[model samples]
Target chain A: MNPKPDKKIPALYGGIIMGLISAIPFVNIINCLCCTGILLGGFLAVMFYKNNFTPGTPPFTAGDCLAVGALAGIVGAVVDTVLSLMFLAIFGDVTQQYILDLIRNMDIQVPEEFYELFEEAMRQEMAGFAIIMNFFFALILDVLFGLLGGLIGYSVFKPKGQQPLQPSPPPFMPQAS
Target chain B: MLLRFFSPTFLIDTVVMKASFPYIVLVCLAFIWCIAPVLPPMLAWHVSPANPLSSQLYTWFSHICHQVDSRSLHLFGMKLSVCARCSGIYVGFFLGVVLSPFLSRRVSLSAIKWWALALLPMLIDIALDVLGIHSSTIVTRVATGVVFGVNAAFILTPLIEESLEKFIPMNWGQRKQGVFYESQTR
Candidate 1:
């Protein structure tokens, strides 16, 4: 158990920084990299929390992991949402049109009977979903990834002496004051 | 009283853990297999104006990726619901979880600092894509996924075990209660 009262602030700061790092353009794309950064961020939070806890505090618990994970998810989600909005605004329509044209060009082998339906299908599918569509998907992914990250972080960075039934209560318990 | 209530859960968890390792891998494989077929329609459904079902379906995967179509996989007749990287992630993750219990001592968490090296494939893939040097083929994407999945599984199981040990805070008496219940049921 750590005796530091100020450690919580640093943990929060770590979470915030991690969130921002995940939100950055391009770098944010690395989230797909096994969610390495996000997981690292969650681990950072546990590291901070561990340092802050008073001596004899129970080593990091699943509950702590979950909390940290949730924060990382929220952070990643916000950044992802913003990026989605931008991606939607640009290149989306062009992409849809490009696919439609490509399919049309490939129509030589395509069934003459099914050609019209196929074209309609491509057009409708690409132009269909709204900005909010992208928003929600980004949000859920970040949360799940964050939760996983938090768990990993807890495992790697958690303090020693945290076994179940060990019951190492904090050193400075308020003595019925 | 608390011990009695929890005894069943522990017994069940232990039994399932011991019995289900191989089955879990199959479950993971089934999940991976399904993704390839379901993805295209789900993606097209989101972008198709004619399909009123698209919006709700789109909402389902919204938190994960832009689902912008190009950044996603094209399976059956359309793009997958999630982005390419995500598809790899879940497929990999499930596989990793399934494979964890069977690993030899060489692959155990404590011995393999090389697990950290697992992050490199993904890093290189994304970096190459960023530089316009290359696009990750489906096979490469999946390969990276498998690597990440293995690493994640290795890291995850131990952490989960540790977390359970801490959060549940069981005593020997508690553990014994579970053991006794299992014996009695048998």
Candidate 2:
């Protein structure tokens, strides 16, 4: 019997998809809808893994889906952090400027102290420690959301009333004269 | 029909309650998750505005939410940690989970189809707003978010319960067989 296909390649593909959606500016907005991007990644990973199954192999289980999703999430977190840092280097905190523009456009009253605090927080956010913290937090969320996505994938893709393959009987031999 | 729907006999099933322990636990966790974002503003109001805890909460939520103050709901003169749409989604999810047991368990639509239907309105609203066609108000944002959230809960809860049922028994059987064989060998 053939062994089940390795999960790493599919997981990597899923992670790349997650990273691109999460790290890209403006595109990352989709994630605000309950981490939809991360979920999609995990779901796609399960789909890819399911495609690898052949007849006679043990059917993929929910536990397998969970593990693949979590691995994808870890990879995605790394990719997202790297891409975000690269964007930050190029764009110089576009998010902060966007927020300032929004506040200005809204004409909301803000105390000067709030501005000071916001700037202080922004400064700290750019620091190495903050970036690492952000990565860890993202990792936690990605794994959780990914697991959910895996469950959804399993429900959608599970074969109806699948049973184990029975070994075929050996060919009957004719009696010799 | 409405009265029957609200009746205690219809609403509460002891067997379902016993069977749905995981679902109940999930609902509680979701409640906590939804409430976390709201508490920062309240804490800032009741306690010092400069409270580190509130700031921490805001910072934590910022990862997941754009949190544009203009687009967020304000309470106690402070913006929520998440946007109005996110707030609506979270609240609606909690409501959906609470109501799931009483609602019909049978699902006619597939998961992807259900998700697409749920997301359609939000996508249209966002597209229009982005194109400078129509600006989305807080009401529109919240309404769309709620639709998506409610649909998501209805789809996910049953699937999760089913998966748990499938996974738990296999493990239980293995453990039981292993114990039996070990005792027989002894």
Candidate 3:
């Protein structure tokens, strides 16, 4: 039986979850672990999809993982863009200053122009560029991480072995006395 | 969780896609790991400020690492792309790859737990620092990072090998050669 369960909804849910998590300020710290947060989103999507699907259909494949991950990543990128804009608008200078302060505490020396460009973006003079950059980053990162997560999730949750299709009840046969 | 590493059906799938070889990819990643740390210092030494590559690497890594100068190793009087901890992690990954051959030829899923265990000290160190119980310095950070990184290497190398090695295509008519391989192993 073709188990054509809709993969889109699950992927959408995953993308939104990842985007929201990545957008938050302090909470984003969880991502310090190799973007595992975004990867989880992808894994969860496949889990959700698998849960909803009936058994006795073609088992899920890596190609399926790629599709779901790509969808989620694309959606997550858009959601992330909107959230970044919102955060920038709301926090404005405080957020800018915080990042600048962190950068200043570091010991590295950089060309003066690089600092100027970063400042320009933080000040919103380069708002459009910043948004575009964030969009691309999220899009790329989510897709790659999502696929990897999907692989991990599949391994974790995959059924041990397809229960041998319940042996068809012994074919009803009339036994001669 | 580690049991997930060696699922038989997963191996079957790996045999089919036959994309890039895992060992080759690992080697490439190892190269990148080595070079990523070295790039910043090298750029500072030779590349002009006007060069986009010089600026690009700094900007990209800034988002990922704190890149604190005092906490990073210097090459040619320049800071690394990441802080000392990150540098150790990458270098550790290289060591992990080298060390993996000595540990096991088959994918040993149980080793994953050890990798997580190795990471605990770093987490504890960071937590204590954040709570103001104690502050960590470059030495503490890099040392903890090395422990975690070394174990992480063992976990990752086998994973990459198991998940990806079978993807290398066989000579023509070699599809399903796995059935024969499976029987032989049995």
The better-scoring model by TM-score among 1 and 2 is 2
Best-matching candidate per TM-score: 2
User: Considering DockQ, where higher is better, how would the candidates rank from best to worst?
Assistant: 2, 1, 3
Q: What total of clashing residue pairs does each candidate reach?
A: 25, 0, 2
lDDT of 3 by residue, B1-186 (tens): 444335665434442223234554665778685687677668768876446776677766654566768778788777887788887777777777655654534434443346457779899989999999999888898888787777766655544554454564343224456666788999
lDDT of 3 by residue, A126-150 (tens): 3677668767777777787686666
Residue clash pairs of candidate 2 = none
Model 2 C-alpha lDDT per residue in residues A63-141, reported as the tens digit of each score:
6787788888988899999998888888866777687677767867988797788778767867999899989888988
TM-score of chain A of each: 0.54, 0.84, 0.74
At residue A14, candidate 2 shows an lDDT of: 83
> What is every candidate's C-alpha DockQ against the true complex, given to 2 decimals?
0.13, 0.15, 0.08
Which 10 consecutive residues of model 2 chain B have the lowest summed lDDT?
Answer: B10-19
Between candidates 1 and 2, the DockQ winner: 2
- In terms of DockQ, the best-performing candidate is 2
Query: What's the CA error at residue B164 for candidate 3, in Å?
Result: 4.4
Model 2 C-alpha lDDT per residue in residues B1-186, reported as the tens digit of each score: 456545665444332323344555567778998899889999999999999999989978877787988999999889999999999888888877665655525446655677788789999999999999999999999999888778777766655544555544433334556787999999
Interface alpha-carbon RMSD, every candidate: 14.7, 17.4, 17.3
- lDDT against the true structure, per candidate, is 0.57, 0.77, 0.66
